[model samples]
Target: MAGENVLVAVEGRRLQLSNLDKVLYPSDGFTKGEVIDYYSRVAPVLLPHLAGRPLTMRRYPDGVDGQSFYEKNAARHAPDWVRTVTVDTPGSSTGAETLDFAVVDDLPTLVWAAQMASLELHIPQWTVGPRGGRNNPDRLVFDLDPGPPATIVECCRVALLLREKLRADGLEPVAKTSGSKGMQLYCTVTTTAPKQAWGYAKELAEQLAAEHPGLIVARMAKNLRPRKVFIDWSQNHEYKTTVAPYSLRARERPTVSTPITWAEVESCREPGDLVFTADDVLDRVDEHGDLFKPLLRKKNPPKLTALKSR
Candidate 1:
C-alpha cells in the first residue's frame, strides 16, 4: 500500500484520510478533522509512550453517543508499513486465538487511526518486547471509579491518599483525570510481570481499603462499594487496558485524559476543575510539555515491601 486517496503528507508519509467534515460529537459539534488534528499535535509526546504498547481501539465510527465498538484487529486496509503485534487471547471451548493490535509509532499512523474515528485509545500496563518476545509491565495503574455522590473530587482525595502510600514505599506516583467522571493514578514500578503487578496492586488496594473503610473500597463488585470510590487495581492484570494518558475520551464532549500536577489535585475542589477539553490539552502540551513523560523514562523502579496486613 504505497498510497491511496491521500489527504496530505503526514511526516513524509502519505496517509489517506477520510470523513473530515463528519460531526462526531453532536453535542459539541466536534468534527472528525478536529480529532485527527488533536492527535497529530499530540503525536510527538504521545507516540513514545505508545511506541511498543499495542492499542485496543474504542472506535466511534459515527460519534461518541452513537453506536461504537472496541476493535482489537488492525483493519486489513491498514498500510503494510504500519506495524502490528500479535497477542494471544484467552481460549474458549474451541481454543486460543491470535489477535493483532496496532502499535501507533508515528504521526501518520496516529492520523490514520483518527481517520478511522478511534476516539478512545486503550493500552495495557505492559508493553510487548522486541521480536514478539515476552511482554513486561512498565506502568502500574489504579483506575478510580467513584460511586454516586462521590465525584471526581472524591477520587482526587482517594488518589492523594494512595499517592502518599506509594511514596512511603519509595514509589513516585502521579494522577490524571480519566477524561470521563473518574481519575487514574500511575506509578513506575519494578514489577515486570503482569501477575506480579496485579498481586501487588491487589495487596495495596486491599490494605488501603482496610485502613480507610469510609473513603476507599478495594472490592471489584459494584454492590460492595456503595458510597465509596472503587480503587480498580485490577487493571494491572494481563488482559485489561487503561486509557492512554493524553487520549481524548468518547464523552459528551472531547475531554482529554490530561496529566496533572499533585498540587493541582490537592487544590481541586470540584470535579470539573480538573476537566480538560481537546483544546485545553493542546495548550497544556505547548506550555508544560509532557507531564507523563518521566513515567516512560524512569531510571529507578519503585521500591515495594510487604504490607503489614491491615
Candidate 2:
C-alpha cells in the first residue's frame, strides 16, 4: 500500500493523494490520511492565520521517527493551482537571490501539503500585501521554551506573567501550546516595526527574568536556561517563523499546537494537563470555537509605541 494513490475532489480541484495508509506517527499508528483529515477539519480556522503569509513546510515524508526537512521554496512539481510568492533572500545560502514560497490559502492547498507529509506549518508574523509586498508584522509572539527540569507547568507560570505584561501595554494576548515541550503567547499589533517589537519583547522578558529569577530566563545561552523558561523574544525578527496554531507538530504522536484558555493555563499543575492531540483539538474547536481569532482582527490593534514610556 506504500504506492497506493487516490484521486479526490477538494473544492472542485482534483488532487492525486497517495499513501493515505502510511503511518506518519509510528508510536500511535496515525496515518497520512488522518493528517489530511485533521487539516481539512481545522481549515476553517487555520486558513485565516495562514492567508497572505508565506509558509515554510516541515516535511516528514517517512514519518516522525524518520528524516525531516525544512522546505522554504515551493516544490517544482507543485500543482499549477498552488499559490506562490517569490521573495528576495540577499544572503543566498543556496546562491539563489530569491525563493518561491507556498501560500496555503485554501483547503485544497492544505490537503496537498498534507499529502506530502508537511506535518508542521510555520509562518512569520508579517503578511504579504495586496501588491505582493511584505508588510510590517501584525503580531508579536513570545515562544516560551522550557529548559531541563522545566515543563509546561513552568511555562504556564511564565505565560501568566506575560499575559499581564501584554495586557498592561493595551494588547490582548492569547496562549497556545507549542505541541512540544513549551507554549507561546501572541498579541496583535498595528504598523509596528519588527525592531520595535523585538526590543519590546526583549525588555519585558529581561524584566521578568530579573523579577522572577527562579521561573524565567531571558538569555538564549543554554547554560542559563536550566530550571527556567526561555522567553524567545527573537521570534519577532522579520525572517523568523513560528509554528502556526492548529498545525500538527512532528512529535511521536499527533500532538497539535493548540490554542488554549487562560483558565486552563491558570489551573494547570502538570505537564500532561496541557498536552492536546489532533482529536483533542477538534473537540476543543467544536466546544469553544477559535480562541485565537483575536489575532486575526485587522482593525484598531494596539500600537507598540504605547509601551515606549514604560
Candidate 3:
C-alpha cells in the first residue's frame, strides 16, 4: 500500500483498508495501491466519525469520456449496510460517485452529513425531500431542487416563502442548500425517535400538500407523482439513508455538498449557483458553526406529536 500510486495526495497521512472503501472506491481510475495512498491522507480526517458505523462508498474514475457511479452492494445481493447509490443527473451520461457512512439510521446519517461537510469543505443537500426520520422526530423538509432550466434566484424565493410558512406554524426551520439545485428547509424539534417522526412527517406533509396544491405533493406513492416536488417521508425509517455531505457525488465533474446562509439564499436565483468549495467550506464552519450540534445538547426529552389531526 505504501508503494502504490497516489490518486489524491494531501501531504501527510496514513491509510488503513476498510471494507466500505474497498467496495465503494474500487480500483477504477486508480489501482488498489493508489487508493490506499489517497486513503492515507483522507482516513485520518474521516475515521473519527466513521468508527463503529457501517458505510456506503462510491468511486470515480478519470477519463475524457466521463465518470461512472457504482454502489458497493445491495440488500438483494449483499449486506444491509453496504450498498451502491447514485444521484439522478437528468440528461447527463456521466454521473459522480455519492458516498455515505453511517451506523444505519437518520440521526447518524444527519450527523455524519454535517460533520463530513464541515470536515471535507463540502456542502450538504437533501433530495427527494421528505419529512420522516427513525431516530429524529417527525418534521417537515422542503427540497429546493434545481429546475431543468431554473435559476438560483427562483429557488431562493421558494425557500423564503417556505420559511414564512414554517414560522407561521410556529416551527423553527433550518435552511441549507441541497449541494445541488435548490435548497432544503428542516424543521427542528425534539424526539428523533423513529415511528413518531414518521407519523409527524405524514400529518405535516398531508397538511402542506392540501394547502399548497401544485406547489407540493405527498410522494408516498411513487406512481402518482409527475411534475410536482415531493414531500417524502420515507427517509424517516431506521434503515433508510441519504447521501452525506462532502462526499463527492459521481458526476462528469465532482460536485460536493455545499452550505449556504438564508441571507445568501435570498440573493440567489438559480439552482446551479453557489460560491462554496471543499477548500473554502471550513470558513463557513467557523462562521455559521455546525447546525446539528444544538440538538445534541438538549435534555428536555421531546414531546413528539403531529400538529395535524390524526
Clashing pairs in 2: none
Q: For residues 1-310, could you state the per-residue lDDT of candidate 3 as single tens digits? A: 3233323212322222222222222223323332333333333333333333344444333321335344332233322432223332233333323323233232223232222221122211222222211133333344554333444455566567667756665556666555454455666455534565566656666676788665556664554444455556555543444444333433333244544566677767444456343334555555666543322333553355566642
Clashes of each: 0, 0, 35
lDDT of each: 0.84, 0.91, 0.43
Q: Highest lDDT: give the candidate number.
A: 2
Which has the higher lDDT value, candidate number 1 or candidate number 3?
A: 1
Off by over 4 Å in 2: 306-308
Worst 10 residues of 2 by lDDT: 301-310
lDDT of 2 by residue, 1-310 (tens): 8679899999999999999999999999999999999999999999999999999999999999999988888857579999899877677577778898899899999999998899999999899976668888888999999998999999999999999988888889999999999999999997656588888888999999999998899999999998999999999988789999999999989999999999999999999999999999999999999989999887888888635486
Q: Pick the candidate with the highest TM-score.
A: 2
Ranked candidates (TM-score, high to low): 2, 1, 3
TM-score per prediction, in order, is 0.94, 0.97, 0.56
Error of 3 at 196 (Å): 1.9
Worst 10 residues of 1 by lDDT: 1-10
Candidate 2 CA-lDDT value: 0.91
Deviating ranges (above 4 Å) for candidate 3: 1-54, 61-155, 168-170, 220-228
